[model samples]
Target: MSEIPRLSKERMNGWAADLLVCLRFCTRVPIPALSFEKSTPEISLAASAYMVPIAGALIGAAAAVILWLATRLGLPTSLAALVTMAALVALTGALHEDGLADFADALGGATQEQRLAIMKDSRIGTFGGLALVIAFLARVMSLAVLTEQSLGLAVTVLIAAAASSRSFALLPLYLLAPARTEGLGAATTDLNERLLTITGITTLVIGLLPLFAGASLARVLGALVVSAAATYGMVVLTRRLIQGQTGDVAGAVQQVAEIATYLVFTSRL
Candidate 1:
């Protein structure tokens, strides 16, 4: 009994520490160091990967609240959806969006070396600008359509998409070698299958929430399938382009998967 209690406490402490680290990595949410620095053992980014869905859900919930407020204020559904997306971008510091831009710009390069160089440049290219505009339009339009149908469904889908997309983003980190010698992809090279499985299971629960909230089961499952396919396509493309994964590749996967998910959720056919 004593051993069981101790083990339970240790697991809880570890979980809290992991959640804090994940939130800090994925968003601009301020978490003071004093909160976890002294309370738990040092946790690696790979170890904290499993907590990403929780962090994503937190981000989505914040955006969902903004969506609710915007809609309630009598804003047009399209405008409200745009405002919600803007809040999502703000909360995440446009981290994934930046990745999508870099990835797009890299595609214009003729060689792997040139591609990597392009991704490293701070300035956006024409391709990058176009990619951002298209991605933003897809996301906002999908949310608007969903919002028009059922507010509750739209809210749940946002949370589910956010959580599942980030979970899928972890695929490249675990499945491919780093494209470079350093950076987030390299830092998380030790990401293991067990951690990914845990994350995937957590994401599944979140993804199903919309179904429980009266979303169509077939559409919800279809959304997940489409999202998974989108992430896989990104992984394959990244491997062919640069021979491995980068932080930008992971970010691109998230953005693409997110868009695919939203489109499926809003699809009528």
Candidate 2:
């Protein structure tokens, strides 16, 4: 009995640490640095990778709360949605958006080498700018449509998309490899086998729970199908273009998957 209690306590402590590390890396949520500043950044991030879904929940909840409050105050659904979207961007520091833009610029490059070089550049090109504009518009518009239908539905979509997309974002880390061995991708792709298993379990349970409670079975299934398909397409494209994935590629995957989630639900409604 004593040993079992000790083991449970240890697990709980580790879980908190993992969550803190993920929160630090994935958001601007004002987590104390003390919880994360002592560990090896690479190893800690890899260990916390599976908790991405939980981090997503935190992020999604913030947006949902903001949207709920805004609409409660008589703001139009469209404007409330844009505010929520803006809140999300601010929370994440536009981390994934930057990835989408960089990857879009890379898409215009003629060869794998050229693609990688372009992705590294800080400047946003025409393709990058256009991609950002289209994605942002689609996200905001889709969210507005969902919110107009029902605030409950809007909250469901936002939280569900955030968690599920991040869960799927784990694909590139586990699938191909880093396109270049010198950056963030290379460091994080080395996911622990046991940790990966745990993450997979959590991803399925956490990713599906919101949908099951807040949406229909069909919607749940559709989101799974669409996000999976988009993730596969991204993997294939990255494999062909850079011969592997990168941090930017991972970010792009998250954004695409999140948007795909919104589009799927909106299309049927």
TM-score of each: 0.97, 0.92
Quick one: how many clashes does candidate 2 have?
0
* Candidate 2 structure, TM-score to reference: 0.92
Tens digits of lDDT, candidate 2, 192-249: 7787777767766655654644677777778878898999999998898989888899
lDDT of each: 0.91, 0.83
Q: Which window of 10 residues has the lowest lDDT sum in candidate 2?
A: 35-44
Model 1, 167-219: lDDT tens digits are 99999888889989989899999899898989989998899989866987888
Clashing pairs in 2: none
lDDT score at residue 200, model 2, on the 0-100 scale: 61
Q: Where does the lowest 10-residue lDDT sum fall in candidate 1?
A: 31-40
Deviation of model 2 at 250, angstroms: 0.4
